[model samples]
Target: MAERRVSAGRRRHRAEWLRWGSLAAAVAVVVVFLLSQGQDIDVSYGQSPASSDAVAEGGAGELGDVTVPSVDEMAALVRADDVVRLPGAIASWDERRVREAVGDAEVRILVAPPGLDEDERDRVRDVDDATVRVIGTEVTGGIYQASADSAVGWRAQFAVGDVTDQMVALIAQLRDRPAPEAVDQFDWRDPDEAELAAVAADLRATGVHVGAGATLDGIPEDLAASAFPDRRAWYVVLPRQPFGEPVPRYGPALAELFPDTPVVVVYGWWIEYHGPHAGDFDEVVGASFYAQLGERLSLYDYPQRNVLAGYLARVTDVRYAGLFDRPLPYRPFDPLRVALPALPWLFTACVAVYLVLSARPLLRRSGAGARTGVNARLAGLTALAIEVSGLTDVSGNPSLTRAIGKLGAAGEALARNLPDRHVRSLLDDAEAELDDTARSLGRADYRPDSYLSERLA
Candidate 1:
């Protein structure tokens, strides 16, 4: 009968454990399912457009009443105007520099940048377009890039060829080409009213009408569709860091957005590493940009810049790199989970240890290990340690040290003479204060409150 009872208890214990384990597994599955339920989004970059669609399309009509300004005409206009809105960089327009560039009139130029000095403030005309305007140093293949990401990141990059007839022809063609699908709008509210009007007038004079509601997508779609094939990307400098150091974030921005157009991102140091310092040339050298989507681009060596451009084209050679609107992929918890698998193991180990420690008290069943008075023994040892270790002046307690010292001496004597007997035999510590208090209370005539105090008094 005892053996049968023991078997029945074992079966019940096993069933209880299985129930708890099943519940824990169910909770884990629910948690993982909830976490994985979200939608996925990602974009693959560097695919090429189909070869059939590779040809540049055009609906480029005549350059109507507005005469196509030759590169020199635009250059001359830039030199002669009172407030010249020439497309150039933020850094290239210091007060003394812009003043010199304008030559005579009290010239002021404004750009979309974070900081400028008191003298710099005096020079800014206004910040109408936040990205940038383009200006070419010399390449007939679209040279200047206009970055429009933001004040901190990469801005728009557009071509500003040498102020030449071919450059003018290209500009006219670009102006007439259809724009792309609408882009997110840009808010153009300048704080200063006068500055706004002046910039408005400058754009108007150049024949590019500034409609009141014009946004970043103001340029018609046809224009963009026409330039799809021949457009060469350039490095458009945007804002710098705390101290005027240029770091553009546009290549990644465009790489993520305008996957159709191969955009390039190059930094200043890249050029510094290759050849002669840019400072030696009296003119501002154009930045070399790259697009990873094109067939591996190779740069032309003569002017030295085309070499960089060439390299960009060659690398982005795969198809679909030029697709404008494709889905971005889903990526989450990859790096974190891969880098630290130990976190889950550590968490599980702690839980298991806690369950084991808690279940220890309940393990005193038929075949379970002996229910040793582990806690009671621990408490006894702790009390004994305190009685021995405390200073003689421990408040509200007296005789504790004396009794403990006598016990220690008795223990030493036992070790020497009666090695086999317990130390309690010699100490004669037959009375425990707590046990005596209980015995005293058990007696019929006990009064804890009144008699104890009176006796002490």
Candidate 2:
């Protein structure tokens, strides 16, 4: 009897030590995480390999083995003989740096426009091979061209049945001169002479170079001569495949007449379709239509600027100048990665400790633990409500608080042998609150007071 008692006591003592020790370890880890958190990855753009490796290591826990090369590393990819392609809109070229980088080598600047047919693309390719080496998808090239001929570069007058207010104002501003001239309109379906005359007058009043769609006879020799009298290059906007026909074969004439001067042809009607849209922003970002190296490093706005800077740095044997716009913030290391994986074991330990400590009281009044059980049930429902409703941190919801309180009260009543109707009523009210929250989340009405949390929650 004495030996058995001693063995039992030792087992209890060992079990007690383990429960407390496990709880202490978990608490210590959580406390340490809270004390040292919110650290961000520090990325040094073209810093040394060691610094780049540090950035890679910083986010290794979150991103998992993703390593972004530094600007210096990317610079090594560009060869001296490679033609650096740039978007025409980007004018922030450091002339000295460009000259120093490539010496006498020439680079291509793309100006592809929208709705470019295969034939048009081929023509552009011919031009590109001679000048710019065209490489990229149709959409990418089109976006590159669109950025080149942004609103600021509009010089030609366009006439359509439904013209935007911006287009009208742009036409007026571009053509408005000392002498009143008419801007011609061609109503393709009706072919209204009076309406066309009126539209022409309105456009000409602003001193714009308006075309009278009178003769599609190969862009009248006189108009060509008049337009390019100085024999200088010009980015001209031509009518869309005159009279809904295919683009006229004017390349031969254009090349012959302006062999010495480069004439870039743009579509007058293309602007009508390119309006403010979600996809436009993505296209612009993908176009990369600016110098890679600039004062600011924005891949969306100016990829070419950075590329140029990188090229210059490579050739000049100078360090990359433009790295990042701002310094990155510091972040704390997360222990959750380790804790989450061992959650089952940790939870089991916690429950064992709780049952062991409260075993006597639990045995005396089994219903005493029912309130904790009820709270746990309510907490689960509240979590579901939060997840479905998209709430960030809803700690002070009156309806939710009332529901939880009623649930606790019902649990106490059940403990005293009361009826289950009170619990049913509380459950109904909680369900109602969840339904209301879901309804609010689904409403799509756009109002000034509408917010993500309010609507979703």
Candidate 3:
């Protein structure tokens, strides 16, 4: 009879475990389904247009009167792997142009100058007319990379700054070329002839092919052509002030004349600065600006040169290497992306509650101090959560630390109700561990590596 009773108890335990497992699986499926909904609402990966379709379908027509780089010119640049600088206001057109220009070349699109209203972003996304693989436009400055199955990752790469330099450096590394040298010292106070001579001499000395010309109106093509003849890429220096009249004509003229050459326009009030290094330009920025611009040039019909003016400072200031280290994949209207912060906490809370409720009967089977066990179990779970949040270093780290203190209070209350000495002893040990962990967290000296080490080994 005793043997039969033991067998029956074993069957009951297995049945209970099976029931709990099924519930857990169901909860997991629900959470996953909710998260996956983000990908479904995004641009369909299956709908990515072919390069021929992009070129034939044409995105230039949508750009109104904007000046577009010639497809042949773009192809040559792509073939030579040269970087072209353009404007960000024409990003929609640029994206399309890049798609058409590279044919089947591996490319990455990173949308930036974040904090645009949702409607504005949606409009921009719709007009760009290509499936974006990553969205690097999060307010927290993270990259949402696309996973192997093309699903967006839940966590973003935590980083901030202008990614232009990193992108430039990355391109240089990829192409096996040295970092582009900067020409920050230019003699802007000299006479027109003297200034032109100095610019030409600087270009020759550094082997840079970029030209510093007032405009294409009277500047000799020989001067511009001679600047960087063999490289097939050209740069022009533009004036920053009195931009209302001269600027419009200046842009179109370059596009019209050099229909085959990739152009980068460096804008500043060059003549105002009389010092020796007065007309200097940040080489990294120039290289990065052109590289990014080149990559996105295919989207607009006409390039607006200074749209990234406000962003220049921030972009150049980014010291973090992780910002553009990976590609950010984003979907339009992803509810999950917007609600990232609250989701993890909500899921943890719901699961913890469910487990406590589901295990109520088992606690009662002990026939004494069942309620105390339930409370103790809850305190233990809460302490674990606090420890995890402290270790992970999320935005909610402070709140999680405070929660540890609260858990300690609750654990003490629950332990006082326990009648058994051994049970109380175990509860005391657990509470002591929580106290130590909480103190470490409070000191802000707790490293995740050490916390992980304790758990793992």
Candidate 4:
């Protein structure tokens, strides 16, 4: 009896090993198949690698040649009714709809012809005092200018549909602007002494020197000394009213004032930085700021404290955190490549789990009962496999039908002798299922149900 028990134990161990080995083999096959199907395996996400030179060059001198109104003319038109439509800029029908869309909002809509020449863009940029200027043209689609001195024309450009549609969408976005919870006001032009001091304190708290004045020349000596000590990166806040000119005028002027030192100039609704290290600001930080600003103007429209704090955070990230130092990983939109590799493994896992669960009853049995259960399951499975194979024509072929029925009967006979009630019931179920499948396949007029037909039912 002791020797017999040892033999049974060894057999069970071998069976477990065989089952696990089969699962590992299946997994290996799946991996090999997937690897063979594709040459390159990409497991990355986001934008592709961008060259430093391309980022540094930026999108500065790309304006095409197109006539636009002079600065004085554009300003007069903006001052007239906040809707400036150049001759032949848009169709009469579109112009009427655009005028209705403007409908007394503080926003100015400038409808220019398709292409905006360099001179024209500069002239349009010169119009200094409008709250929000939207230039709709066939060439650039839509240009959203927050201020006249905007270093970058159109914080966000929309080219979807015609110029008319773009202008209407731009106007709607500004009119229905959602106020941010952090900002209580949209006026930041002339912050009082206390407000300036608060903004200065906030800037200094973030480990950067802060300087504030009506103009760059008027900044306090002590504040200027601290902010620009040793010609390093610093922050300067100026009132929107003082800089009556566009950023192209003051941005380079400040850059010359403090040569080699990185200077961030913050005005209400406008932020510009200059220095050798400020290229990333133009490439990454500026785009990020404008994108955020376009969504919620409050970032720049709010008080200096909130706006400067937000600007400082972005500046610090680009300067120190190596935000754009590495090229972002890109995953292409090939659904087949991504989904195909995962399918075989998923199917194998499910089959493995089912096999283990179904074999549990057989594994629990000992000696002759175990053998009986195993034989019964094998016979039932063999019949089911043959029925599934669709290799033999069992329909109208009485011999093939008899063969399948006989296999099921043999399994049932073997199951009857097993002491395990669960194993006996499982074998019985298998026999019934196999019989049903055989009968279904045997019918001459049978048709399979389609996905749509079943769903409708």
Candidate 5:
């Protein structure tokens, strides 16, 4: 019985140890998984030294005959004047107006001559911190860069014409505002003033601050007004032109106009937008809306008021819904990608549940074993009382004496299995009582008649 009990105890302890080992192994898996996830390194879009080397090697291999302006010279020119027009560059008569509009601001504009080669364009692009830098060549169109944080170089196709008026108008809207107003509409081309005002009123009704103007001359005063306080985004609607005609690239210029906020331009049949929120605008309202507008305008030889109104209404709807506030929809079959961010947390929760389940049975068995041990000890005490009272001797029954001795042996076995110090003391006391009884009964030695002893042997 003792040997069997010892084997059972070893098996229970091994099972308990296995449960703890499993938990440790589960924790190790979570740690390893977390370590494998690693960190994300942010990559900036700004030009770097290595990128400059690559561009020099891959682009315009040799500087050739094209003379490129030095960075020092460009910086000096910008510091001296707000508007610098290099030789052969597009001449704008509105340079004085641009200067007047820019007054005291750090903004600078440099217009490169038409027909500048790639090397010359690259040199102009290399000029940093300029508010507006444009290369006026038709072959590569024109390139403009703004000094804003989210500014990116843009290319616009413009006919060789006096852009001085356009530049002055752009600067006027850009200047004095300090910030972009929400849903400001500029009608650079001829449009119905009443219809435009109606569109603005509808947008205002939807709880957005809107400012609309039909002329470029009124921009400065309108911008200074306190009616429109929210500076967030702007939309420019240019006069509709023929499908194949090359109109001035006002979209890129308008994008540079605000610098900080997104600007959308509806020029002729083309729709262009730029800024940090450009992607959000595309996700909320796609380019298809403008494409359909172009298709509808094709049916009419002249600009229809209702058609334009419908288009403006759509723009108003997008503005009312908050263009940049909406989140982009997830791509198809992208469940795993979306859930990947939360995978570590989900894995931890699953591991915790597994640990709880694994330990529950072990805990229950330990508690049951403790209670059974105490009950067996009490039963053994009852048998010891019967022996002490001389019940078996009074009946003169050998079977009764053997049964009582077996019960006492079973109790001793239970007491040995118990871990409590009090149970051990009870076992020692029971053994002392058995020894006294044995001596009293005329036995030379005390021997417990346990049935398990014979069976186990």
Candidate 6:
């Protein structure tokens, strides 16, 4: 009992601590999260080995293990490389990190995200390649310019060989003015330079091959001429793979354009955040991604906290916990089930309530008048009355008293005159109860409440 009490005390303490600790931890995490939120730092995650039914540890926050890297052959392309590619919407590269990742790379390629108005992404498809890599899925075009500090003169990456001073000046100028004139949507504007040779020579020594993707015809010949070194400069495009072959294979135009160049297929409409209801948030997330990352965008549920953050905590914590113990076991859950395995306490509470309510009335009324055996007192009273009235007792004898209750047969006729059934039931009940009393054979006390004493005395 003491051990159980100690255990109970410990349980209560632990529960209290958890409650308080959780509250404190929650506030701390929130404050810390908010504090760290606007910085360049961002978080990441994946699934757990502990749970089979569990897709991710962060519970509802995780969208399952996915990113551009988790997708098919594209995973190889997402790997760290001198090359940074963009083949989706203007919103796709909106994330500040991704924006920087692409904008600052030795080479960058971009495609328009799907659902673009024909004019919006017209520059992307004009390229001769089989694919057009989408740019920013979650970023707006306005914010993409602001955050990248690459004010509207759009230029893809260029490989350097004999870096002229003019080319160096052009690189810097392109870095400053990324999207040209905001004038011709398909102009594909880039700065022309031949100013710095040393940097270009240094770039070539790295033995890095860099090519970018575009809508082949989209880059106005003027812009392509300015952004790249020569007409020999190349770009990529994407076409739908032939269906029904065992493995989907790239078709002719895809192969013909850049046979020696790295091939990156751009999928604009691929699902991002898929768990249960994936499509619901994708539009807003993919469209506003760039500005949101730059903190220039606001008012949406797809923010890191609402979307990726919860997932980060859920999966990371669960994954981290595995270092100490096997993770919580998993089984499928049915919400509608009346008997859920998680609700054992509810069942126990119901049963305990039933027993308590039932037993209380029994315990409370145990010694009410009937239990005191008033009928035995009435019998003694009747004997006195009979002694006074010259009437016979229960045995049908003209006697004042009789030992033993064979007299009950005689008493039955007299008992019919009584009005209260409760009193009468006492007579029936008393005889059985008499056997149960502790004073069953003890001498009676003649207190007024003690009805059996009067008759015997």
Minimum summed lDDT over a 10-residue window in model 1 is located at: 293-302
Q: Give the C-alpha lDDT of model 2.
A: 0.33
lDDT of each: 0.29, 0.33, 0.35, 0.45, 0.42, 0.30
So what's the TM-score on candidate 5? Answer: 0.27
Cα lDDT tens digits for candidate 4, 163-236: 33444555555677432222111212344556545544644465243444332232233433332344545566
Residues 184-204, model 5: lDDT tens digits = 112244335564455345433
TM-scores for the candidates:
0.22, 0.24, 0.23, 0.34, 0.27, 0.18
C-alpha lDDT of residue 183 in model 2: 29
The backbone clash count of each candidate, in order, is: 68, 27, 23, 2, 4, 74
Ranking by TM-score: 4, 5, 2, 3, 1, 6
Error of 2 at 209 (Å): 42
Q: CA lDDT of 323 in candidate 5?
A: 46
Question: Sort by lDDT, best first: what order?
Answer: 4, 5, 3, 2, 6, 1
Using lDDT as the measure, name the better of candidate 1 and candidate 2: 2
When superposed on Cα atoms, how far off is each prediction in RMSD?
22.2, 25.1, 23.3, 17.9, 21.8, 27.2
Candidate 1, residues 160-226, lDDT tens digits: the string is 1111222223333334433222222212222254543443353335412222321222222232222
Candidate with the greatest lDDT versus the true structure: 4
The TM-score of candidate 3 is 0.23
Compute the lDDT of residue 212 as modeled in candidate 4.
Answer: 43
Angstrom error of the Cα, residue 222, model 1: value is: 23
Per-residue lDDT of candidate 3, residues 188-215 (tens digit): 2222555445544544454232334332
Question: Against the correct fold, how does model 2 do in TM-score?
Answer: 0.24
lDDT of 6 by residue, 164-219 (tens): 22222333344554432222111221212331132233223531212233212232
Tell me the deviation in Å of residue 49 in model 3: 27
